[model samples]
Target: MRARLTLGFFTITLAAVALVSVAVLPGLQSRLIDAKLADLAELARQYAPELRKAVGTSLPQSELQDLVGRTADLTGSRVSVLLVVTSDGEITVEAGTDSATERDITLDFSVAIEAATSGRVSRGTEAGPNGQVGEVAVPFLFRNPESGRRRVGRVAVFSSPLRDVEASVAVVRDRTLVAGSAASLLALLAGFLVARRLTRRLEAVQAGAGRVAGGDFSARFPVDREDEIGELARTLDNMRRQLAELDSARKRFIATASHELRTPIFSLGGFLELLADEELDPQTRQEFLRHVRAQVDRLSRLAVDLLDLSKLEAGSLELRPESTDVAELARRVAHEFHPALAAHDSHLEVRVPEDVVEVDCDPERVAQVMRILIDNAITHTPSGTDMVVSASRRGDAVRFGVGDFGPGIRRAMLPHIFEPFITSDDAQGSGLGLAIAHELAERMAGELLVESQPGRTTFTLQLPARPTPPRPAAPPVVTEA
Candidate 1:
């Protein structure tokens, strides 16, 4: 991955440089040639008059060559004066600096001819001895007595080689290549460093996840960075912490469940062995049989509780929602516990409003939660301790509460009271009831809360209240015929 990233960076840099070079190099050369041509044209215009006067008179060839050479030195170019022969309609080079070189030069005089014919300055390029040459021509004008107008008499041609512009462009091209290579190298180094750092952080997170998957929750994710990687690290670390807690809870649950199951199975085994004694008295055999039956019942209830809790945690338990009058539901559930209440020597008072407390909920699940709360209160409280089962509507929620006037729960135990297999004072019931109830409440989009003190302990289930739909108006009664 690191190598791929570095190559990616180098590839992008090279692509950019290639694009810029293709776009700029040609234009740069063309612009430089144009600038050189313009400068030659301006210089020709400045020296045209002097060259025309010299050509108009009968000056010696050496004197004319000297004058041309002086102008060439001043302008940093080759200077030539061409005579326009109107009679023959032709142009001939009258004088020039570097006579021998100019005679054999390859420069085409098209610009000088065009300037003489048009009576204006002209500029162009052509093949020369060394390389491409830019030339500019300025026409010399004189009054024509016969035509009553000015006419070109002579032309001054100025030219310069384009080798300097080519050299400059070549230098720029070479520099661009060097700079692009340097930039590409830097990009590769930077990419490798960044990818290395990123890979290390990701590997650490992967290692931590692997440890957690292997049931070793001691490994922790790193969170030292302040980038996206850091945020990822922090999130993974938080997951690690949560997984660790869940693992600890899972181990504790397995231990408690095994112990709870073993006790009843051992008791049932001993009782069954005792009952098998044929010489035993009838009363003793009956007592053993009773003990076996009780243990069987306990085991059955425990299995059911475990199943319900597992289904709730696995999100497999479906809820059937309907509009229910919790006030009526409360009375029904409390009435079912009459036998238990009587057995415990306790009275369960139902406090429900005359008005219906309507809610959209699964009535069976809500009833199950109520049973758990009421049973918990009865089994934990002292004998003859009174309890209250109440249902009421508060704003947009309906609450069902069960309170017992008995010794309250320990403060330290309240936090984990809703956890699986939690019991207060080693009570004689499977401790999965409150955990199942809490899970059910949450599944129904509600909350289960507990408040306990010395005199009273209350468990409240708060569920969202569904507003009752209004009834339709009745049609008017039919009139008598």
Candidate 2:
């Protein structure tokens, strides 16, 4: 916008200059021509009386020419004098000694002579053999004493006006053009400096925004100036600090709630175990025992989820990476969940290649992911449903999946499925199971993905594969330190 405004200013200034120059040029040229004509007319008026006295009483033609020559030399002009009757006219040339060679030329002087005789001055520009010249004619009148009538002779003057007018206008035009050009250049330099300053602030804002988007709540902008941009930067910095404080408060709340819940739950389970052994009817003991077990399970799940969230947030979850057979890992987790599957009337099916599909991952964390997936499938699916656990090599990675035929997760809930405490009506396990599994998988340099439709759901875990050297067995321990 600034650049455009500057350009507009320059355009208007230049146009105004051009218009004024154009408007004044023709008038100035005319005035210059008229002034030269007036000077020549005045010189003619002064010389006319002297010339008439020199050509007194019908003087010889040679003597009249000599007087004309003397007048031309004194005035530095090419002069001409004419006398005419009703039927004929005579002309004599008075050439200047210092001027260029004189050329005899024909001109229509009848109009000029008529104007001079009518007591009016006549002046005009006319083309000559050499170039354009300014011409002026004035009448020389004397009284006839006996008849008391007027006798008249005409003196005409011509001079070049083009060179003088051109020289004067050229100077003005050149000055105007130079000033306009310099102004334009200054405007461009100013625009560049302003653009650079504005872009610098904008770039800093852009970088701060990028950091904020990347989850850096502590990211801030520099406050170096007191302009609007500086105010904006300070506001952003304050917002970042506030966000960091809020985030810290939220994490602290979660940690405190998880820790406080653990103690009472452990006590309740311990007292319930003692009560189970006391003298009581079988039915009451069994009911109390079942409730205690449920409470224990709930507390265990909450504790696990809180721990996993804390580890993920703090960036302190250590991964013991190793290359292991991913297919075997999936099968092993399925086997471990066999009892739970059976209890739910669900059947576990393992699908894997006979050859090992190796991957680089934390074996324990990968197995934990498989356990979470299989358990989730068993808990969500209807009784007697088949839970399939499968693993395969997919390009540079190995993929392990646990799928179930059940009333799958709704589309709206899919986005938040891995969030802690998120659950559907069909979900029986702690919601943190999936969340913990996802965090652990990522720590092991792998990923966990979920896909579900109306009647099917699959959780897939993928990890990179590379050959790893076998670990050497530890040497037998010696008694010596």
Q: Residue 268 lDDT in model 1?
A: 84
Q: Cα deviation of 242 in candidate 1 (Å)?
A: 3.2
**Could you say which candidate leads in lDDT?**
1
Q: Please, what is the whole-model Cα lDDT of each candidate in the order they appear?
A: 0.86, 0.69
Estimate, for each residue in 1-481, the C-alpha lDDT of model 2 and write its tens digit: 4566556656766676677578876677678777777776677677756775754358777777777777777765555565534334533323221122444444544535564456455666666564546655555565778899876544444333356656776786788778867866775676667766777787888799789878887677998899999999988888888878768766855665655575557768676767857687788777777877777776777777678778976888887787788766776677787678768887677777766667777888788788778777777777887777778775677888888889889899998787665666644555677878888777767788999998889999888778545444333221100
* Backbone clashes in model 2, listed as residue pairs: none
Would you give me the overall lDDT of model 2? 0.69
Clash pairs, candidate 1, are none
Model 1, span 1-481: residue lDDT tens: 7788788888999998898799999999999999999888778778866887887678988898888888888899987677666657565444433422644565667888888888789999888778888889888888888998998877778888899998999999999999999998998899889888878888888888888889888888778879898898788889888988898899999999999999999998888887778899998888888888899999999999999999999999999999899978998899889999899998888887776668999999999999999989988998989898888877788999999999999999999999998998877988999999999999999999999999999999999997765444343221110
